[model samples]
Target: MTTTSAFPAANRPVGQVIVRASHVELYRDGQEVLRDVDLEVAKGEILGIVGPNGGGKTSLLRLILGLDRPSSGEIELFGEPVSRFREWHRVGYIPQHAVAFDPNFPATVRETVLLGRVAPRGVFHWFRPEDFAVARSATELCGLSGLEGRRVGALSGGEKQRVFIAKAIASRPDLLVMDEPTAGVDPESERRFYDLLGRLKDELGLTVIFVSHDLGVVSARVDRVACLNRTLVYEGPPRALHDEALLRTLYGGGTVTIAHSEEEPHTHGH
Candidate 1:
């Protein structure tokens, strides 16, 4: 493990427990973004959070990252309160949108991925040799080796997505939260990305929480699904969520269609 000598006092959790959010309520400017949200993810589980556009999926993720505080309730990571998790290295995140960087910026894929190790400004700007090894491993896992020297802007939508994924996995975080990771990718890329996720979960024992608007893909990929609409509507195995009536209740009514010969897939905000 790469030593973060800078934060020597940082508290590192022991054992396999990863993330737990309890009775979380998030309010923005007096309007509630999330209400009474309770969630938990153990190591090696790929959990999916799905809902309509304003359903607070992103808000839930932010709360887990400690980027935002819940108006009420508590969040715990590795048995410690989120407020006490000084080692931000244990968590990795991929936001819904691509990073806002100059298209012509001269940054190689490896260099960009190494940036993830840059701690708070006061810490050392240097990345240790182990950091490079981690980054290289992530790149190879994402099949981005040959493109390491390529400029960030020169990649396709799927390629750029892989770059971001590589960056997230570079540090070998115990938990990864990805929001709308396949938004712009083609079907083939999307399928491949999920396969990659499954492999990571199995090999690395990573607890993944991924949110997407596509129910078909999410249902096929994740071990379990949670329907969220400012609050958790359901939490159970994907097989139980195949009900058309349940889909209508969760998505505010839509023409339920069975994609890939599976039971009806939910659609919302159409």
Candidate 2:
């Protein structure tokens, strides 16, 4: 595939670099999972990080979220170094697994989303009226308005995913990070989920950084794609990822195939 500019000129300057990793290297159990990785996430863009299993995708996310420190190099969030950054509320994170609620858990949909406010509201403080209003607004935004009172445990997998997304956006975060968000959803649900993300980016001016293995979804939805396999193999627009040799290098020479779409000329790596 031919390389095109990663972002249009108009969208490029919506905000400063929200996340930056410079020469980052990570090691676990004497094994180097990531080496000399450098990445940047600007405002108002959906960046998809794609790679095979054990490609340090989740490790990179953990470092960005401050859950783990890199073995070397540096990271910055919102122009502030990671070590000194204290504005955790500006970020919203949705982990790989769904919220594990018991079948009889009494939390309602609104209540579940309200948990996101705890960080800003203080753990020991009581919820204020604005907190409830924010949670309700997020619930409605995620298409769960009618289900505000429904038990979270009784919802479908797709609905559960929305609930988590609502929770992440409840704080009106500037950046939203998701790991394998569509892992358990059906194809239709996945499509709708990506559509929702696009809407969120336009309406909320939110910057999204997500880790996904689904090449079709990445190609169709994300603004930029980064292929990682111990290192960043390719970092550019999704359409630029048309080289079969590059795909083989990223996927470790697996039997790769490209599926094309009829409606639009796009490639899906497999």
Candidate 3:
């Protein structure tokens, strides 16, 4: 398979850099988690990041979201330094396993999604008519319109995931960052979710950055793929990642298979 161009000039404006990282490094407990990493995310692109567990995938995302600071090097969001960037509403994030919300929480689906609008509405302001409209539209877009009144705890794992996605989309963000959004979802549900994501990307012109251990899904769906293990080892089209030698190098050489089927292939390492 030939590698596809990640940044097609016809789809988006030229030289539109949404996220840029230069020589970024991070340390935790005196141990290096990321080393001299450099990355760029163009507008309207789906960038899939894959690597083994503890390979600093989440760490890199944290730096981008301003959740954590890099020990050295520079990072920028929308051309502004991350530390000074204040336009958080332009970015939406869904953490791994949708862990930000408690499964047993008593909030309804609509109410939970309404939380997303709070950022734009300010810290303590009440939800206005427009806020409710946006939340409802987002819920409908995520196929959760009928379930809006249901308690979040009563929903299944897949439904819960959709609720979170609706919450993210309610913000109307330009960049969407997801950390293992399909972690605990069933196979069928996961497939449906990815399909929805593809549609959403096209309809919203979203720039997505996602981290996943599922190589098959990453290869099939993303415009570009980056293999990170402390440092970036590969960064290009998914077709370029089919090499067995490269797979072994990324996963530490036990066994790796890239499935081209409709479903994601099973892999041993994270």
Candidate 4:
């Protein structure tokens, strides 16, 4: 029986935050997208960011990953200012719509995953035997063991996601950040993806933060949920998603109707 206490974040001191955003605000083309956002993620916790479309979920991720800067505040990774943080090998990121890239790109699953090693091993370093070993292990962990030789272009959306995850872990990162990771995958595949992530977290002591539009995935898999709609509307336990009062606050007077079942996760509309 695995518990949250088994993870480093649960056992560590109260103040060991791995990621932090303090009073972060953003503006693109003179339009404010995010405002006064302050969040902290402890090591080993799987934190989910959720919100309505155009809620700045992806925008927040960019700041956290250092892909974009905040207009008015600070963002930190591994306790260092994201601007000055240079230990990038310790981070693994899968951007939003990762599978939307060109399908004609010619690269096998193994070869693509091996590319992750380049960032960690240095661009000038030749591929070592251990790199292959690492890639193989990552494939197995992501359930891509048999598809190693297959062209990534030929794989389905779900399969491509698995290959990308394999590549992300190939670098053996301490923090894994994903933006809308399961966007186009089916329900069963989404469940399996989160399951794989749970296992990876336990085995690797990884800290996970991701943007998820699916409320069910956040409720079922994440340690905490941050609700954002241009700003932080809520940040607490996943169970709060079911609170009608909270839903009203988050959705801004729109009627929210939740429809759920055993197989597929239907959305709660606002």
Candidate 5:
């Protein structure tokens, strides 16, 4: 039975945060994707964004990452306006479908993870001894220990994901944004990957916002579930939003059944 208490809760500031989007709008080549979307993610919480294809899930991630600006509305992260927080180092992102480069990229796993420490951020102006130490620590924490010398392309799906996570955490950001970290992996690998996230959030005190299509399993891992269909449909705890009617509405009429255990209360709605 998985519970929120299975992992240690973050001890950092779980203060009232305003990770809000005020009437946010996004356009791609004159076509509207996300229309007037409003959302918020509190501190010490894992917010899962689930939706069907082309539901603007990736676009929303881009907006929050400051990779792209909204056509309208404002985005605030951690009570501070995103635009004003020039410290991009405060955030980490594991992008969707991120795979290892050419098998001949000529970089070790440790070296690739160290790329997270490369210039321009406050985390490290240059690759210093402290940076190496931090990278080493992150690699170990992500369970990459002795495999640091392995070539990235040679690793399995789960191992590759862990390496990217290590790279992201090497920066030691306050917020970690992961987009579909478990996609395409085997079931065993997928479960292990999520277990790693659980450990990271608890031990490292990082705020996680991940996007996934595996609603059933993902719902069990997060503190809150936020359904988006070009805009916000529902946002609340797993139990509150894990109803068939709500999911059907969000997915636009699809059947979903969730199995529950007597030892662990599970909810499914669609």
Candidate 6:
């Protein structure tokens, strides 16, 4: 684990709990989507949730984001029960397929990012100088400085993703949540995207929670991982992915390729 994983597993500094789920269970349409899920994320930690398709990874995220209610159990955001949590300005969410805009959409990068502020400030309210300042900063941070006036529809997939991220961060949320943000991005773009996330974490001290199936990147970038498979299979440091039993339980003997650091990826059936 030490030879492969970059983050040290022991003596990790403890921070405030930003998200917590206890005994969470959800049954939708008579199908059990999640069961007995207990998860917690500390402030400023990058937590990755990984699972097979239809394994309740998104379901859990939806619950955490308060999009869907859990049938039984509790979820809290920033120590407040999710249902009672109303400080939405402190949270930013990028849903799955959030960047699936039509190629001909008329909104420019600046316009789209400005939308993030509309929710925090009333839609009826007019934009202020501070709003433009924040939007510009977010655009620049996302590397979309030169394309502020360019139509988002004309941008490439990776550029579109950055635009969406810029929009998400424009609100200056303390917690940034994303669902498969790298879905349509190319490999190079994915690398840059994670790098941007690292910058956001450092510069803004944001606590990030994202759902992804890209194990290679997840293993390398995240501080902790919660492997979901209709239940919580494993929760610990990225180094825990090396456990064959844990991988088998989470991936169910699927074709698993784990790349450790700059070292080559190793394939194992588990």
Q: Cα miss at 242, model 1 (Å)?
A: 1.1
lDDT by residue (1-270, candidate 2, tens digit) is 221223221223245799989999999999999988878889998999988888999999999999999999999999998889999999999999874446587888988999989898977899999999999888888889899889998998788899999999988899999998988776666767888899899999999999988776687678988888887777777875566666777786656555445233223344
Better of 2 and 4 by TM-score: 4
Candidate 4, residue 245: the lDDT equals 67
Q: Candidate 1 on 54-73: residue-level lDDT in tens?
A: 98998898888898888999
Report clash pairs, candidate 1: none
Q: Model 1 Cα displacement at 31 (Å)?
A: 1.6
Candidate 4: the clashing residue pairs are none
Q: What is the lDDT of residue 259 in candidate 5?
A: 44
Give the alpha-carbon lDDT of every model. Answer: 0.76, 0.83, 0.85, 0.84, 0.76, 0.84
| Model 3 TM-score, 2 decimals | 0.92
Greater-lDDT candidate between 3 and 4? 3
Error of 3 at 167 (Å): 0.4
Quote the positional error of residue 129 for candidate 2 in Å: 1.3
- Candidate 1: clashing residue pairs, number: 0
Residue 22 displacement (Å), model 2: 0.1
What stretches of model 4 exceed 4 Å from their correct place? 1-15, 259-262
Write model 4 residue lDDT over 1-270, tens digit each, in one string.
Answer: 211122212222245699989999999999999988878888889889988889999999989888898999999888899999999998999988788767998999989999889898897789889998998999999999789889998998888998998899999998999999989888788878889999999999888999987886577788888888888887767877787766666666677655455375756657
How many clashes does each candidate structure show, in the order listed? 0, 0, 0, 0, 4, 1
Off by over 4 Å in 1: 1-16, 99-102, 120-122, 261-270
**Residue 155 CA error for candidate 6 (Å)?**
0.6
Segments in model 6 whose C-alpha atoms lie over 4 Å from true places = 1-13, 261-270
lDDT tens per residue, model 3, 22-92? 99999999999998887888988898999999999999999999999999998999999999999999999
